[model samples]
Structures are given as C-alpha cells and as structure tokens.
Target: MGVQDLLKNLLDWVANLGFWGPAAFIIIYNLATILFVPGSLLTLGAGVVFGVFWGSIYVSIGSVIGATFAFLIGRYFARDWVAKKLENHEQFKAIDQAVGQEGWKIVGLTRLSPIFPFNLLNYAFGLTNVSLKDYFLASWIGMLPGTILYVYVGSLIGSLAQLGMGERSRTSVEWLFYGMGLIVTVIVTIYITKIAQNALNQKIK
Candidate 1:
C-alpha cells in the first residue's frame, strides 16, 4: 500500500481503540518518529486527532520518550558502529567533539535547527560525551516551540477541513486569527533557527 494509505489505516486503527486511542497513537507516533517518519506528518496527525492542547501535550510526551529511547540506543548499543562511520566524516567528527566541549547547548542548538537528520542525530548524540539528563532536558526544551507551532497548524487545518474552507473563511475572524498565527509561527521559527545556525557555526569553529 502507499505510505499515506498505510498511515491513514494506522490512524484509523488507533482511533478505533476509543479512550485509549490517543495513548496508543502516542506510542505509535513515537516509534514512527524514531523509524524516520517525517515529524511534520505525525505532528499534523496529532493535531487532527486530538486538537491543539492535547495534541501538543501528547506529542511532547511521546517525543521526549522516543528521543530518550533513541539516544540510549545510540549511546549503549550503536556507539561502535556509529563511531566507525564518524571516523571518516570530518563534519560529524567536529560535531561530536564540539558536543563534548559545549555540552547541552550543542544539543539544544541541533534540536532547534536540526542540521542533521532528526532520527540520525538522536542516535548520533548517544556516542557523544553529553549526559542523558542534559541531552533530554535540552531536547525537550528545544523541541517545544516547533512542536506547538506544528500542532497548532494541524488544529487549524482540522478546523478548515471540518468546516470546509469556504465556510471557515467566510468570516474574517477565522482568516485573521489563522493568518496571525501563521505569521507568528514563521517569525519565531526564523528567529530561533538563526540563533541555532550561529550556535552551530561557533561550535564548528
């Protein structure tokens, strides 16, 4: 089956679970993330299924747990393999070493801007010297803003889909609120990304 079909089927199954649906989806989505699922897609699913507040909460919990699990897998199980690969990668080597020197700040910056693939970086950081506590803390905090923004967008999209675009936007308030939210999210994301870029540059140097 196509990927979208597979994803929809999975969501449908999860929804059939009733009161436990959100919990089930949280676990499934967390695993999906570590398996290299596009976070944006899963995030939108969260928003669609749970609305903004619950979606954000569930995503936050699931993301933190999944990231920690991925980090541990990298640190304890895959370090040797990952290390061998990094031996030939100067940029990655630089990041590993810089993470050693810069600690959680490096972790925070990467989580914010994500120079590396999200799934890979989770495992990659496992080989670094940063402590699990620091890594988890920084990751949770760094991932927060982006998570909320995506979930909120998902909620908005859900509203549009349910109400129909024509009906929803027939009034100016809905359009205005969504427009303002989009603008704010874009501005915040840009600002944070610029900071992360600077942080990465400094760490590289």
Candidate 2:
C-alpha cells in the first residue's frame, strides 16, 4: 500500500480502539519512531483524534520514550551498525563530536531545528557522550513548541471540518487569532533554528 494509505489505516485502527486508543497510540508512535519513520503525519493524526491538549501530551510522551529507546539501541545494542551507517556522512560525524563537547545544549538546539532527520538524530545522539538525563530534558523542551504548533493546526483543521466551511464557518476573529498564532509560532521556530544553526557552526569550527 501507499504510505498515506498505510498511515490512514493505522489511524483508523488507533481510533477504533476506544478506551485503549491513547495507549495504543503511544505504543504505535514509539515503535514508529524506532523504525526510523517520520512522525509528522502520525503526530497530526493524534491532534485530529484527541484534540490539542491531550494530543500534545500523548505525542510528547511517546516521542520521548521512543527517542530514549532508539538512543539505547544505538549506544549498546548496535553501535557498530549505526557507526557504519553514518561513517561516510561527514556532517553527522561533525554533529557527533559537537554533541559530545556541548552536551544538552547541542541536543536542545538541534531538536528545535530540522538540521538533521529526527529519527537519525535519536540514534546519532546515542553515539555521543551526552548523558541520558541531559538528552531527555533537552529533547522534551526543545520539541515542545513545534509539537504544539502542529497539533494546534490539526485541531483547527478538525474544527473547520466539524463546523462546515459554509456560512456557519469560523468567524473572522477566530481566523485572525489562528493566523496570528501560526505566524508567531513560525517566527519563533525560525528564530530558534537560526540560533541553533549558528551555535552548530561555532561548535564545528
């Protein structure tokens, strides 16, 4: 099946779990993260299913757990394998060393930006000298704003569908509010990313 079709099926299955849906979502999300799957679609699906507050919470929990597990696997279970995979990538080699020197600051900053793939970063950080505690805290905090922004967008889209796009559509005030919020989120994300990129460059020098 196509990737979208598979994701849709996964979401449908998660939604039908009723009382177990949230728990199932966490497990699925964790597994997906470990499997090197990009989670943007799954994260958005959570927002559609659970609304903003709960969706954000669940995604955060699942992502952290998955990242920790992936890190552990990279560090202990398959270090040689991960090393071989990244050995030719000079960029990642530099990041690996930078993270070792800078600890959670590097981790936190990188998390705010998409300088590297999320799943790969999870494994790459494991290959570094950063402590588990530092990684967990930095990742959680760094990933929060982006998580909330995506979930908020999903919630808005859900609301739009439920309210219908006809005359009963959202008020202009609501539209303005969402628009401003999205703009602010984008600006803040970009600002943090710029800072992170600069820090990364300095560290690499």
Candidate 3:
C-alpha cells in the first residue's frame, strides 16, 4: 500500500479504538517527543480532533509528563554521556551554567519565544543540572498559552465549518478567531513569563 493508504488505515484503526484510542495515542506521542518528534504536529492534530479547550489540556498534560520523563532520564541515566558530548563547546557550558543558576526562567523564556525546537529543548534540558521541580513547573506554565492558542485555532476552524457558513465567510471568521487567539496567547504568555522570570531572578539572587 501507498503511504497515504497506510495512514488512512492507521487512523481508521485508531478510530476503532474509541476514546481510549486518542488517549493511548497521546501517551505514545508524548513519549515519542522524547525521541525528537516535533511536538507541534501532535498538538495541531489534537486540536483538529478534539477541539480547543480539551485538546490544549491534554497536550499540556502530555507534554509535561514527557518533559519530566526526559529530565529524569537525563539527570539519572545520561547526564555524563550528554555532558561529555557537549564538553568542548563553550556556549553549551555557559547554557548549562545558566540553567543551573536560572533554569526555570530560561525554560520559560524559551517556551514563550518558540526560538528552539520543543523536543530538542526537552532533551537538552534533560542533560542540564536544573532541578526537576523547577523544570516541570516552568515547562508546564510556559507551554500552556501556545497550546491553548493552537487548539483554539483548530476549534475555531471546526466550529466555523459546523456552522455551515459560506466558504468566504468561514475563512473570514477563522482569521478573526485566529487573530484573537494570537493576541490572547501573547498577552497571557508575557504575563506568565514575567512572573516566572521575576521569581527565578529573585531565587537566583
């Protein structure tokens, strides 16, 4: 079978598994994030299938769980190996030190900015000396806004289609909702990031 046919079959199989199917997929997807899957695809798919609010919640939870797993694995299993891999790099060493001193703030900033690949950040963080609690908390809070924004965009698309409006009108509404979601996401992200940054700076000082 062709690739599209295989994907169709896989989706059908997932559908046949009922609600448990998505839940199971989510667990596996989050785990796969550890292996460097670009998490945005999964998040977007979740939004498409589940609508915004619930999709965002599920994505958030799964991401946090996956990130925590990565962090723990790095801390206990692979820190030495990973460190050795980066030992010759001055910038990597600087980042490692920064993470040690201000890990939560840096995590929050990266989460807000979309400057780095999410999976890479997760694994790189895993190799850092940042505390598990700080890592989890920063990731959980930092990721929430973007998750909600993407999911809401998907939900808006679905909702517009369900409304049976004309194609042009639906497109317009989708853009409108997307713009609104973007504004909200940015505002909330900034506020939360500031809070986390302030707290981290105080703690570091």
- lDDT of all predictions: 0.72, 0.77, 0.64
Q: How many pairs of residues collide in each model? A: 0, 0, 0
Best first by lDDT, ranked: 2, 1, 3
- Residue-level error in angstroms, candidate 3, position 112: 1.4
Against the true structure, candidate 3 reaches a TM-score of 0.67
Report the CA-based lDDT of candidate 2 relative to the real structure. Answer: 0.77
- Quick one: best lDDT, which candidate? 2
On residues 18-86, what C-alpha lDDT tens digit does candidate 2 reach at each position? 999999999988999999888877787888888889999999999999999999999999999999989
lDDT of 1 by residue, 112-152 (tens): 65345677778888988899999999989988877877777
Off by over 4 Å in 3: 1-16, 84-91, 156-205
Worst lDDT run of 10 residues, candidate 1, spans: 160-169
Clashing pairs in 2: none
Candidate 2, residue 25: the lDDT equals: 92
Clashing pairs in 1: none
Superposed on all Cα atoms, the candidates' RMSDs to the truth, in angstroms, are 6.0, 5.8, 6.8
